[model samples]
Target: MSDDLLKRTRAVLPSWLAIYYDEPIEIERGEGRHVWTADGTRYLDFFGGILTTMTAHALPEVTKAVAEQAGKIIHSSTLYLNRPMVELAELIAGVSEIPDPKVFLTTSGTEANDAALLLASSLRRSNQVLALRNSYHGRSFSTIAITGNRSWSPTSLSPFQTYYVHGGQRYRSPFAGLSDGEFIAACVADLREVLDQSGGDVAAFIAEPIQGVGGFTHGPDGLLGAFAEVLRERGILMIADEVQTGWGRTGEHFWGWQHHGFVPDIVTFAKGVGNGLSMGGVIARAEIMDSLGANSISTFGGSPLTAAGALANLRYLLEHDLQANAARQGPVLFEGLRKVGSPIVGDVRGKGLMIGVELVRPGSTDARSADAARGGGPGEPAPEIAAAVLEATKRRGLLVGKGGLHGNVLRIAPPLTLTADEAAEGLAALVAALEECTP
Candidate 1:
């Protein structure tokens, strides 16, 4: 049945819409942290639908909210007074760290980012923007221009003149050998250089606290905060693209920017607030948000259904303190992966439940061996090894995701409610998979 569906899907879907695995399985349903396929095979979901199913699969609170809202009404465009939308907005604004924050909802992270670009460009009256190297913002025309990753960006034509800077990832960076303080200084210097070449008027400096599609990579802590200080001096707004790192997924902080000890001028979020609902939004200061003289509204942005569901999901996340859960379980999984002692596993990094294991060819001059001293330098990206491990893990009834500029990094982001036992089980499966794929 899945084979037939795959054929049908291939016929209709765009070829660029990448699917996972050589033998793709159609997910039939989900509950808690596990999902079943059309063949009734169950697997523990680690990637959480690319870190979108944040809280859990089929969370009852979100389900009830959606069902109840659907019975009442789904969407009543943005022109109407939507109580649920307003309530959700209020809740988001209260949590957002921006001064006098205002929220504008959208349907996805892509839309949220697009809207943010519009706001920043319009307010600053300049299309000149600064984005970190190896960043993946979105697939839209505006976002593709800012994206520095070659694999994810398909086009060069862009509305903004985006200057790609250093410091998104440390592993493959030119300054990787530097100490943390030295690395921060080098990146800050690079940012200043980029600004010098921008002819003075740059709109914003947009960045992901952790590069999601770029393989869950980030520089030293406080790197972005240091960059923020420079941008602030130049009247450039800092937009924290928290689509993957928001809603307390990072564990230690509610927002990823908090980890850096800075408050951004604008923040864009999606992927966890609604758990699995199609929801996203931008939060900014009132002055910046209201800078647009022209009227705008998202048709299905904050519809009653999505808003209600997202509200329930956010409430549950806070009440249950899943952030604490992520903080607790993240280390268990991280340490377990490190202890696996897989030669191909070059580096493992990230915060909370969002972790990445970079695969590499051991013993190569450009690659770090499993037992190599820490920060020996990033090894040669072994995308083939990553592919093999993906297949092996699938065969072992475990699901994970792969990413990075070269697709050599394994992304391991599970639902925040993941337990220690489940982490152990996943780690065991991963260990077996690595052993099977080891040369």
Candidate 2:
């Protein structure tokens, strides 16, 4: 049945839209941390639909809210006063941490980021922008311009003149051998150089607290804070692209930027806010949010249905303190991956449920091995080994995701409600899979 569907999908869908596995499984349903294929084969879900199913599969609170809201009304354009939208915005503003915050809803992270770009460029009166190397913002025309990862950026034409800077990822970095303080200083120097060459009046500096598609990699803590101080001095706004790192997924903080020791001028979010619903938003100071002279409205941005579902999802996440759950479970999962003892596993890093296991060739003098030998360097990225491990894990009834500049990093992000037993089970399966694929 899946084969037929796969054939139809391939015939119609764009080839650029990648799917996982040799034979992609059609997920028919899900509950909690597991999903079932069309053939009723159950697999432990580790990716959580690319970290979208944030709370749990089929969460009752979100489900009920969507159903109830749909019964009354699904959408009424932003022209009317939307109660659900207002409620959700109020909640988001309360927790946004930005001073004098204002909220604008959108359908996806791409749109949210597009809105942010609009605000920054208009306010600064310049199309020049700064973005982190090895970072991804979105797929839209405006966002692809700022994306540093070439694989994701389909074109060079862009409305904004974007300058890529260093220091998003520590491993595989030119400054990888430096101490945290030294690394931050080098990155700051690099930023200043870019600013000097950028012809000045750079609009904003955008970054992910943790690079998601760059394989969940990040620099030393307070690195962005250091960058922020420099950008602020030059009147450059800081925009935190928290699409993957927001809402306590990082565990230590409700927002990933909080880890950087400063608040951003603008914060954009999506992917887990509505528990798999199509929702995204941006929060900013009223001055920036209202900078535009003309009128604008998102026809379907804060529709009744999505806003209600997102509101319920947020309430549940906070009430249950899923952020704390991530904090508790993240260490258990992180340590388990470290203890897997796979020769191919080179490095494990990230906070909370958002963890990455980078792969390398066995017996190679990679950074992990070099560090052990007091050498300290990066490994040759082993994308082939990563591919093999993906198939092996699937055969073992586990589902994980992969990404990296070299495509050699395994991304393990389960739902925040992950149980202790589930973690152990997933770890055992991962260990066995690695052993099966090991040379």
Candidate 3:
């Protein structure tokens, strides 16, 4: 059944659409922490479609809201007064963390980011933008222009003059050997150098608190906080791309930017907030959000159905304290991986439910065995091994995810509603997969 569907998908879908594993399995339905394939085989879902199925699959609150709203009305455009839209905007503004914030709803993360870019550039009156190296923004033309990953960026043509900066992901950074303070200083100096060389008319510095599609990678907690200070003095706006890092996905911080101790001028979000409904938004300080008096409205941006459903999801997430659940379950899964303790696992890092284990080719420089673990050549990215492990994990009734600039990181982001038992089960499968697949 999957094979037939895959054939049909390739025949009709765009060539660039990516599928997972050796054979792509169709997810027919989902429960708390699992999904059943078209053939009725269940797999423990770890990635949650790149962290979109945030709370849980088929959450009753969200489903009920959607069904009830749809029966009354779906979309009535933005022309008339929409109570649900206004109510949701009010809720988001209260939690946005920006002082005097205003919200604009969109249909996707790409659109939210596109709006942010346009807002910043229009206010600053410059096309020069700063983005962190190894960051993945979005696939649209404008967002792709700012994305630092060459693999995900499909085109060279861009509307903005984008400059790539360091310190987004520090594991493979040039300052890998430096201490945290030194690394922050070095990255700050680099940002200054870029501004100096570019003649200093930069519009904004946009970055992800955790680079998502680039893999679940980030520098030290205070890295962005330091950068924000430097940019603030220069009158440069900061945009936090919180599409993946928002909604308390990163444990210990309600927003990923909070881990760094600073609030961004603009924050863009999608995925998870809607709990699979097509909804996204940008929140900005009113002064910046209203910079241009040019009136604009998104026809289907805050439709009644998506708004009602997303509101229910948000309420359920907060009332049930899903963020606290993520904080509790995250460490359990990480400890399990540590006990796996395979040489193929280079690093296990992330917060809350979002985690990643970078893979390296086994026997690379023998840093751990006969030779000492110091001053050895870094292991090459083992993408082939990652692919093998994905297949192995899938066969064991576990569905994790693979990513990274070099395609060597296994990204694990289960629903925030994951239980301790489910975490143990997923980790057990992951360890077995590693043991069977590691060379």
Worst window of 10 by summed lDDT in candidate 1: 364-373
Better of 1 and 3 by lDDT: 1
Computed on alpha carbons, the lDDT of every model, listed in order, comes to: 0.91, 0.92, 0.89
TM-score of each: 0.97, 0.97, 0.97
lDDT rank order: 2, 1, 3
Cα displacement (angstroms), candidate 1, residue 128, comes to 0.6
Residue 124 miss distance in model 3 (angstroms): 0.4
Task: State residue 338's C-alpha deviation in candidate 3, in Å.
Answer: 2.5
Query: lDDT per residue, candidate 2, 1-439, as tens digits?
Result: 8999999999999999989988999999999999999899999999998889999889999999999999999989999999999999999999899999999999999999999999999999999999999999999999999999988989999998999999999877778779999999999999999999998889999999999999999998999999999998999999999999999999999999999899899999998998899999999999999998789988999899999999999999999999999999999889988888878888899999999999988777654432546655666689999999999999989999999988999999999999989988988888888888888
User: Where does candidate 3 have its weakest 10-residue lDDT segment?
Assistant: 365-374
Q: State the lDDT at 11 in candidate 1.
A: 97
Tens digits of per-residue lDDT, candidate 3, 39-152, equal 899999998888889999999999999999999999998888898889899989988889999999989899999999999999999999999999988889999999999899
Better of 1 and 3 by TM-score: 1
Candidate 2, poorest ten consecutive residues by summed lDDT: 367-376
User: Deviation in angstroms for 367 in model 1?
Assistant: 9.1
Superposed model 2: Cα runs more than 4 Å off: 365-376
